[model samples]
Target: MLYSDSNSLVSFNPDTHTITVIRNNIRYDFEIDSTITQQELFLRGMYESRGYELSPIAKLDSILHINVIPFSSDTEFVSLKLDSLNNELDKFPKTHRKTTNMIPSKNYILGFVDGESLQVYYNFPLSIFMKKAWNNILTICIITLLFIFLMFCIVYLFKFMRNLSQYQEDTMNKIVHNWKTPLSSIKTMVELLQKKSISPTDEKGIEKTKFILEEVAHIQTGSQQIMRALIDAIHIQIDRNEFDLKKELITLIKEEKTAHSNQTISLDLQYLLPTTTIYASQFHLICAIRNLIDNAIKYGKDAPQITIICYQDKNNLMIEVKDDGPGIPKEKQKLIFNKYYQVVDKNSGQTRKGFGLGLNYVYNVIKLHNGRITINSTPGNGCTFTIKLKKWRTK
Candidate 1:
């Protein structure tokens, strides 16, 4: 009593007096009669009592290979050659567009059935059973593909990281070799200087001593550069203490002026806040400020016009370092703060000297102090690095 729209082995012809069944292109007809049997009525009553309703979409793939015993017969079994019929069909598609799975699957329970169960089992087509069950086949396909792609990406990333680690180790080895020679020379010079005390009044000895001291200064500068690079490469730990922020900025400006005496430097300092005392690591904060100013000097073409703006906003102290220089490109702006990332100059096509860790160090130091730094720069307009810190109370 089931009807589906698609391909089916058995279908009905429009006739009230007869029932038509088609199997393998052959048709058979049976006359409808109102004959009643006591056992049939009993079985039908039991079937209806169980509330058994078969869906139209649920077609029988076929009966199982094993026999279905009828309660009416003691020695006879009704069987279907479903396994042999399935073997003659094409292989099941891995991800079939035409999704139809076998029904009563291999695990379906076998038992004796009444007349009603046998009628439907023999009449229904096996192909129709899978209509509803395989509906989500497309979704399954997409999810499976996505899972495979994710696994591929994870494997590629792991390989890349391993290669990067090896490269870093090799680079460090060469740097250490270069570092060891200069340190050895400095050590030897100090030993010799200690052994031979130059006479107090010898003019030639004094000039030689001055030359030795200048050479020692060069060695010290080299050592400092190496130390600074290492410091930037590691994590920053800040020791908090209260310090006058205004005083430190003045000292920073003066030191920059003294260091670059030949160049004309103009720093516009604006302090809008009446109170400047804040609790934080004074050394790292000043160093961060200095790095901003140093970057301004290093990248600026003309006499650098720098401005330091300090003010209070809500419960936070804000400092803005502005410079008149060739500004960063929109794309490279964020990348400038990444450790060991350097921006190649468009004009020179060469990156400026020193480890590219300066700005990265500045960012980490500010972050460690529970502060943040941001930048606003464009191709020709210059850069402004803004720092925000939570202003702690002195009292």
Candidate 2:
């Protein structure tokens, strides 16, 4: 005969009068009466096994009732016992014998026949199986709640990133639109002044005014390029054309020198190639270069010296911008190109003042042109930024 619980299997052999139970990869055998019914095999095996112990009714303050009949055919040979109720065995009533039916007013009864054909009964106030089922239900509910919370966090993060991207695009639009009118007025004023007749001493003033106008023009061009780039989002669209790289570098250097005339900064250009022509987005490339130069001016030491070198190496054109500035630390070099990542001032223990978007923009522009940029610097020394691009030819 075989019987099963939620976690264990019990087998009983009437010829051998032995019971075997297997649970959690372990097996146990018990000796009992051959006449024990299959319905009571689990109870009989558990009671007879040395390792198995019965628990009292938890709801009834650890109370349990037991009744034993020495002979199945004779009710006269009976004995009774109560656990955790403080009553003598002899004083137990014979009329209160163990029955198969459980009474709601009394306790639940579980009975099994022993080896000598004796009936054993145990009364419990609650079922242990129901307690295990309730615990499993609670565990499932807790796991479900945790899954819901994680999904909500993921959704919220996605929406937050989308909103932030939209806000950035709107802000760029406003800035580009607002700067155009003033830049146009400055250009017109400079043109009008150049038309006026001036003495030889005022020639220097006219030249300075022209330089300021040129710088303002560069700013206007850069602003328009950035607006277009923002509209595309992530991928910058470039308008490629063949242009002289050497001429562009010279023009940018002159503009920076004029803009920061009061500062004792020197700008030098080195050309190692005979021709510096390339097919690229001239406006965006100029903006990227200007950002590097502006960063050097803002962060470099007193009377900073900046060098712009261009050369052709086989199939690639290389340009390097070197600055004699307070060098960047090794740890921060990789992170400097990330959007919104700023350098912290070691002396003041505060973040350096800037939007932290210049290097990110430069990186994107270079990527769109199928080029690469690298930084080489160490603390207390100078920094160098190298850009390599494929040389262009008429096809």
Candidate 3:
């Protein structure tokens, strides 16, 4: 005897070459042959197994017009009158290729009739058995890997396009700077020459010459900035530059302190840095320092106090410029370093006008050196700009 959770008992009858089932107080019997192929036996076993697990069992007896059961609920078992009786029900059934499916259908019909209460007795359809789960899991894994590959490709393409866009912007900026410088210089020189030809005793002529010299100096400063930007953009684009981390950031700190002797700020530079030299462009480093200094001078608040310090931290250089300024709002700190961004003095309420390019130049220079610069500021508190440059050595 074999029992399954589908509420059936199975037994074998060797004399009759049959399989028998007892389910819900009803008996079902199947007459199969010893001559049946092993494949057909296996298929029959599978259907019988499903019936025991999922539903009640029934034996199809084609010879009788009525379905046979031991006991069925009065609410469930009902007889449907046949409009025409076919003596065909008495014949032993013919087996077709599709007859394999009918075994489970026969079992389900028995289960439905035992449980359902209806006037009409309808045929029940068999459920399609789902294969094992591993195959489905494998298919899902394959599809997921394909989707990940596609996403990676899209990210790579976007990165490439962004780099291309940056290159074009750098080129345009350089060209515009170049064109503006020469014309500006020529205009200053022309103005100076004209001043010299004016009345000899006119003191205004001398002042005009001095003014022309200052104009030339300003243009020189601007030219240097543009050149630095162009070089940094090119080297960084090619990945040829790295941070030239210094162990003694204090060296520059002391020099800057001496340069701005009147400021009330104090210096504190302490973060461990490697003594090892980094491979970087010298021009870019100097420009980075210059931009920071320029920023400190322009924006330092009470008594224009600023402190410059540096030190080594692991494999990088940490240089900091802190100032007691009418601190930048938290929201504005990020925007301030962007190109063409400037914060006006709160007292003045007017947009402080310069090239609005200083901090932008600083950020680009630091980045080209494969470094990062960040701002720390709070309202009513001071601001500190920190530059971190990585350490690298040439093989």
Candidate 4:
């Protein structure tokens, strides 16, 4: 942190194998640099000059609390450690210009010389980066769990379908067999991750790793809640009650609009539907509707527009959700409502990631209310999902 004569602030302790740097009149200790080679420094200089991505390893030395790492050789330099990182600073100037532009401008390089007179380049925030990594890992874990569950469902459905016909039995068995490899691979990968123990080399690493794992546990609880909802749908256990359909939808749309401020969402829309009361589980219906809206958001293009339509069609109350998103294929439409089925990315031939239960839960939840849901879509046009429920019920 010494703005003037910062070079004089650095010193080395051979006996302790550490480096000491005085910043803002406070003493900071870092381990002595021993591992980096000249070739790696050369590569580092080239990589930072052309690439925008920040380095994974955080540099230890800093001026005025801004981090800077060695981009030049150790032939002539000062060793520094402020917050436990042992790093070297090159006495040369060219490396500073190459590395500073790669990160956000919170860093300024004044005089050059391996981040010397001009200092601080790509000050990577390890904790923030670590959090992003943990979230991605957690998402992958939840998806793997869903894939496993769906695979089992396919096997179970195959068994049930076997009783229907011999042709279906063979076809279903082939599907189950075709699906096994990827499922096994995912399962094996997750198992390996679960069994392997991670050991952090320093106190900072240990703290960050512990924080990420703890966060993973918190998010896993949320995933479990979603799975619980899917399981409840499978069991067909929902409390039925009479609620004003139009009012419910108006509220739903209002909520959705708030949740997706960037996207356009509307209800009844151009014209409001007349008041219609229907006997059904409001909780289940709301969940189902939300699922459809979520699907629309994910599959929709940037700033996608969604509209909820409600009206009376004879004795049935009809509700429709329309999205200005990529339309579903005709062949994939039927499979969409099947348990554990997700639309494949036509371009990549990869199954799209989705909520754990997906449309299958919505389909079943609607069916439980003696209602039906249908999709009307054409590729490149957009998608519309309509739900029809009896206006009145006898319980």
Candidate 5:
């Protein structure tokens, strides 16, 4: 094989156990091919035969190359390029770093020759230990980075859960406090009316009494709203009565559509609900769907079109409500479902109130069903809310 550099030309034959060393018109014939069988034998023969007393192996088994060049007269007789000896040695099966316990070095090349019947070894003063050290350092760095990233995620998750638990507790306390005032007012009014007997024909007196009674009834309604809100928040399912969900949805849809024919919201059902009944509370599901439909009507900017779709795909049964509304802003969508929060007009900014419990109730209902609800909307475009429930089978 021919090996070349800017200053030298060298040739070696693996078929014959010989290497011609020539550089600057000088030549030397070397026959060091047969000393490869024994482990220490090669090192001894290399030092003795070539008079190149290079260490067989250094501290930490680091191999050093000894370059041998031949010369004769001022002009030189045979040229010795002293080609790198480790380049070819690397490709050999038994000469790798693990087997030799001697790492390769930089600024050095290794060459090995294999005859048809024997092998030859040549060495030069050069060191590959830097490569091995850098590889080990790189591996350590990667492992350290991975460990740090995992630790960060674990810490973040712990803090998030702790904060969420605190928030839920605060919400529960507020609900209970709001619930007591209306209930107390209702109780006081009822007690006072029971103690006094007033004639029904006392017109003026009866009118005043009716007004008081109406105020008391309004308080009762407010209290019921609070109680229902709390229940919806806590239980998710407003009713525990067993009913076939498909039949219930169909019935409720027909009634609602008939009652609100003026709205002209279209029903587009493509369902594959099993004939077998599901273990679900129908009242909560109805409430959830009704709330979604109401929101669609309230927010839709154009023709107030709504489409209700139900179908199953893969592992989930999906209910999708779509509307061409002045869709909610992405930033405000999450807060819109919070209790006592509502979207108001931009011009007048008038606040329309319904206790702000509708969406929250819907959220709880979906949660009780172990279903996921997602809203997709774009401002001035449209909105779609999809509910996904885990597929189940019942006999």
Candidate 6:
């Protein structure tokens, strides 16, 4: 029995002519000739011990390229063959034998001695290093892409929220402006009544009272219109009634002319049919017409000439509102009916007043009646908005 390091133990069995080695908790057995000399046995044990120490180096050689050479004093004794698994070894120049004191140029060398001197050389090629780093490179690329996508989503969400906020603020300002005129009128009437200098029976007093009542009615109508719009936005059903289409247009034109009497805008109505009845929501239809007239008056150059032609063709009632205002650009005609999209004046490069919701509302109202609207315009040639509705049939 022979004990070497704390982890290695060797035992020889004379009867069975076998040697057993226990190293690092692993056991190896080798059969021997029954007449083998003690010196040969010792040499065999030394070889096995040295080979066990080189096992880790062999594993590294399988992953990299390593050269092993044995020397005796200053003379070359033996050189180990390249590992069969190292396919890249043949691509590089062969390693030359060197003296013990000479420094290696490329390979890393490790030297040790048993009974003879041995040196191990290891070389790390670029391809092998890149192969080991491939997983990290892929992980970095995926993380960078995910970060970019996240930033894009965040920026898009912020812009959408900003646009929504601006739209809401503009709508509120328009609502206040709309209500202010009637409210001011009501306030003036009450202040006049507070002055006790006039009798109730006086004609002027009665006229003042009537004007106050008219202002209140106007406020009520405005409130009702706002509520109707809100209901429509929520997709609620609207009430429909049958009415004379020609008469409705004539009445609406008169009302608009009276409302804008202070402005010099001209309103012309041409009726191709004396009487045409249509089943529709009268309030929404009137609102749609009013929006177009108001837009003409607001955006017109000087005395805007608006000509509205109402006629019947086949089974459809066609109404065309033509205005001789600064015409809309060809590019913007398609987007004008979209909510919150406003037309910009090409010459001045300034946006027109209003919330940009009027045309969109008109579009929605017309669609609710199973109608379609189309626009035709050229730069500086004025604009025409044409609406077609299915004629109501009485069964």
> Which model scores highest in TM-score?
1
Alpha carbon lDDT at 201, candidate 4: 49
lDDT of 4 by residue, 1-395 (tens): 11123323544455665555664576666664456443333333323332344232222222222212232111122222122122333322323444433443333333333443323334455554555588898999999999999999999977665444344323323432333223334444443444464344456655655565566445544554545453544344455678876676666666555445435544335324555666877666876887788788777877777888777788777878898887989999988888767776769564655544668878987887778999999988889999998844543
lDDT of 2 by residue, 1-395 (tens): 34343566666777788888777668877777767654355555544442455432211111121121211211221233333342323312244555455332332222431221223243433444345467887888999999999899999977776566456544653653357546655666676676675444787987888798889878876875676466445544555689987898897787677556557989999989777777887767876887789888988877999998988888787889999888889989999989878887668565565667788988987897889999999877788999888745554
Candidate 4, position 146, lDDT? 100
Give one digit per residue, the lDDT tens place, for model 6 in 67-184: 2111111221212323333222221113444435443233322333222222333333445545667899999999999999999999997777656544543453355336634454
lDDT of each residue in 154-243, candidate 3, tens digit only: 999778865764675556445434544454546545554765676668788767776776776576567656654664454333233444
Using lDDT as the yardstick, the better of models 2 and 3 is 2
- Which candidate wins on lDDT? 2
CA lDDT, every model vs. true structure = 0.61, 0.66, 0.55, 0.57, 0.55, 0.64
TM-score of each: 0.45, 0.44, 0.39, 0.41, 0.40, 0.44
Q: In candidate 3, what residue range of length 10 has the lowest lDDT sum? A: 69-78
TM-score-better candidate, 2 vs 3? 2
Is candidate 5 or 6 superior in TM-score? 6
Residues 1-395 of candidate 5 have per-residue lDDT tens digits of 22222333345445565555555556555554554433233343333333456442321121111111221111111111222342332222232223242422333222342321112232321323334366787888998999899899889977766565445444543543344444444545544554465665667766776677677557656655765566556533132345676776776566555434435666544456555356555545665787787677666643477777777777676888888877778898888778778877677564574567777777766776778788899887778989887833332
TM-score of 3: 0.39
Q: For model 4, how big is the CA root-mean-square deviation?
A: 32.6
lDDT of 1 by residue, 251-284 (tens): 7787667555447989878989778777877767
lDDT of 2: 0.66
Q: Between the candidate structures 2 and 4, which one is better when assessed by lDDT?
A: 2
In angstroms, the error of model 5 at 168 is 21
